[model samples]
Target: MGFQLTADGFAKTIDALKEHYLIYAPVLKKGTGRFTDTDIVRYDFVNEASEIELERKSDYAFKEFLTPLSETLLFFTEDQVKAADIPDKPVLIFLRSCDLHAVRRQDDMYLNNGWTPDWFFKRRRDLVKFVLIGCKKSYQNCFCVSMGSNRSEDGYVFSVETDGDGFACDVPDTGFVPFFAAGQAADIKPSYVTKNDFEVRVPDQVPGAILKHALWDEYSSRCIGCGRCNYVCPTCTCYTMQDIFYHENGKVGERRRVAAACMVDGFTNVAGGGEYRKSQGERMRYRVLHKISDHKKRFGENMCIGCGRCDDACPEYISYSNILNKVTDAVENLGKEVQ
Candidate 1:
């Protein structure tokens, strides 16, 4: 069923949910960008619905709420150790369709990859519920439609869309019925993007021979290795763990997991000072192949969600979309020669 909520009613409903759930949504943080002269869009805990930013795509994804930029895994002392405590409250997250798909990818890596589930990720995943924020138009760099991540029915508890003077929300899950009782019932359908300014068509098969191909060298000078691409991507899950020691007692403190980017220095470093990818071109090759072929070969889907945040976050303006097109052409030519 669906319901119509006035702006005020929507705020009240979110306030009500605050009693049971910690709400995380994309928010506008004014004067926080690089120059401190522009507004930045990032996920933040919201107490009321008014705090949510629905008009724009966040510069980063909602993954921070789950994986977090940095989080304590455990606390340790000379003789004793304790696991980090999980919050008692549940979590409610608002995300768009592409980001919701990104969550599934993270779940596949953290929860389903190993014999046992990741307790840290699972603990938060189990307590969280998703609310889809309707997308009516495509953003500047977004290619979600091209990646077939424009809509999803199973991940969200409900969806919210703006209509004239009120919000039209559809509650597919019966458990969410209680939340919309205060609003007027209406027949509303969720909005999704049917078209985008950009499109990416990955080849049906990408040969492993492309690994040795020199196509990626174009990025050697263009890429500054700032690592912004992975930082803004919703599906980039690589992380580095750290242990912080107390000043008074070197053996006491906490171990933490901090997000890591493959493009950054020391990512491929080894014990003997050897690095797997010494050049920026090689690093770029590994990243592109992993997103377009390697990950899909194992997971049956591309790791790149086509959210286009990588393109937007690039200081050198490297486009993952363009790289895919080049790879597609190379793979097709390689196929022809073999045949």
Candidate 2:
């Protein structure tokens, strides 16, 4: 059973939730007409229901809200060390089906994979909950349907969709029912796209030998390594830690973990200036394989949710789905040549 509420009732529900949880939702940031007079959509605190930006896909993923881009790990002072204090308030995040799948992939890495889950991630996981923002249509460049992540059967506390002048919601969590105004039970189905124009053909197997293929070199000439793709990706989890000392004490300060990109320079750098993956092509190859094959070898699922934010965020116009097709062709041709 479900409930339907007008726009005002929806706002009242959100306001009611604010008393218990810190609500985060997609929001539109107006532009100054400097570039193309387009509005930038991203996640922000939703104080009112009208602030949620459901019409367009957000340029940034909600991953950072679960795992921050930069966070202080601990503070140290000679003899004593102190752990960083994390926020205690619970968080309720509104996201799409693909993004919900992204949260699962992230959890697989930070929680389920190892014998001991990452403590920081575990803490964040305990404090966060998800709400599905039903997607009725396809977003440009999205390939989640191909990845089988366009719909989520579970993981969200409740699902909501806009219907005419009112909002219809499937509230599995009974606690949320009090917020809705006087309404009768109505069946509400969440919408999902059946197809996407942009398709990715993943090969049955990307042989280890394919890594030596000359095709990857194309990225060396075209890629500038701006690292926008990683920043916008929901599942890119690599990061680097830095230790900072206080100006006065020189011994007391904090250690921080800052997000990093495989495509960025010095990502593979080590002590004595030794570095692996020297070329942009090498970095690109590593990233692509990790998304499609490497992670799946251990976790049995692709790291990419096929949100296509990487395709949209790339300044150099790189298309990840196109690359997958190229790799597929190269692998097939290689198999034929060997036969």
On lDDT, the leading prediction is 1
TM-score per candidate, in order? 0.97, 0.95
Per-model clash counts, in order, read 0, 0
* Residue-pair clashes, model 1: 0
Evaluate residue 298 in candidate 2 and report its C-alpha lDDT on the 0 to 100 scale: 80
lDDT of 1 by residue, 107-192 (tens): 88899777998888888888899999999899988899888899887788889877787788888988888887679988878899
Off by over 4 Å in 2: 32-36, 182-184, 248-250
| Cα lDDT over the full model 1 | 0.87
Global lDDT scores for all candidate models: 0.87, 0.86
Which residue pairs does candidate 1 place in steric collision? Answer: none
Candidate 2 per-residue lDDT, tens place, 63-154, comes to 87777889998899988899899878999998999999999889988888778998888888899989888888989899989888999888
